[model samples]
Target: MSASRDTRSQDIIDRVEAAGLRIPAWQAVCSVLETLGEVLPYGTAAYLASSLPDSMGAEVGRHFPADSSASQVDRGDFVAAVARRCGCGVEEAERAVHAVTDAIAATVPFGVMVNVEHVTPEPLLDLITR
Candidate 1:
């Protein structure tokens, strides 16, 4: 990775770790991105990935197929997916989701996040918002 991307990724990891979720910050962030890959439209995911640090962007792109349509993932299922990916329990997964989303919100533009909120499901809205 480029120096800038590596620095940005570390910044994000530090923010997520500050949330005290116990799981590794990079793992938590990747798990959340993978779970969101199931919910966000491909275009949305692409836009989001573009805004992220290189490695995190690739994580989203890896999980979300360019041609695959997005799903309206239920909150329970979303948490479960994250939990499975992070090898953590439901509560920890939920915290990670919130922390990762907060990190994403900090990195991306406000308009992009507005678009993300528009496509995201109501049940899981709180997880994505600050």
Candidate 2:
């Protein structure tokens, strides 16, 4: 892998550990972040991007607040996006979402989670709430 890839991987691992999960959770969480970054409105995406490290900022930067409101995707579409991004089955993708978000809920500050939740759409509540 290139040095940049290695650095990005390391940054992700550090973040996963900081979230009280091991490195294994990185892909799922990254998928969620990318999907949100792709689909959220500019203000909402910026809210989430601000919480992430600089290394990760670029992954979502391109689509973060895409030109049209049509860029927004629904909850089922989000799950499918994660599945397609991870090359996993929908069930597994859903499980990963639940696991990753649950870890975030456990480790991230409550206020930050609330801020994120405020930016998230209603159909996706189960990703964090359940």
Candidate 3:
């Protein structure tokens, strides 16, 4: 990877760290989403990855349409899925995802965030904002 790309990835991580989550837990949240992406339609995973740096987008995304009939998981289920991936309880996972999403949201304008909301379901937005 180019130095600029590395810097960009570190920039995202540095921002997440500033939001008060450690790298490992943030990584867990990301890993969980990447796995969830495999089972979901590409759109949700793609949009969710938009707030991230390119390498991270790659890290948390891979196969899509793994379940041909699958769609985006709702918020609670999304939390549960992430929890399972991180080997943590659901509530704990909620905190982790919440923190990371909040941090990412902080980097974008409110208008962009609203656009994100348009593509994202209400429940999922609640998960991030609440």
Q: Estimate every model's Cα lDDT from 0 to 1.
A: 0.85, 0.63, 0.60
**Candidate 2 or 3, higher TM-score?**
2
Per-candidate TM-score against the hidden true structure: 0.91, 0.67, 0.66
Model 3 C-alpha lDDT versus the unseen true structure: 0.60
Who wins the TM-score comparison?
1
Q: For residues 36-90, what per-residue lDDT tens digits would candidate 3 score against the true structure?
A: 4554446656665664567666654666434343434567777777777767787
* lDDT tens readout by residue for model 2, 63-129: 7446346335488888899888767878777776666556545543477568767766778777757
Better of 1 and 2 by lDDT: 1
Of 1 and 2, the candidate ranking higher by TM-score: 1
List ranges where model 3 is wrong by over 4 Å. Answer: 18-23, 35-41, 47-51, 65-72, 108-112
Query: Candidate 1 lDDT, tens digit per residue, 10-76?
Result: 8889889899988999899999997787688888888988989878888878855744433446789
How high a TM-score does candidate 2 get? 0.67
- How close to the true structure is residue 44 of candidate 1, measured as C-alpha lDDT? 86
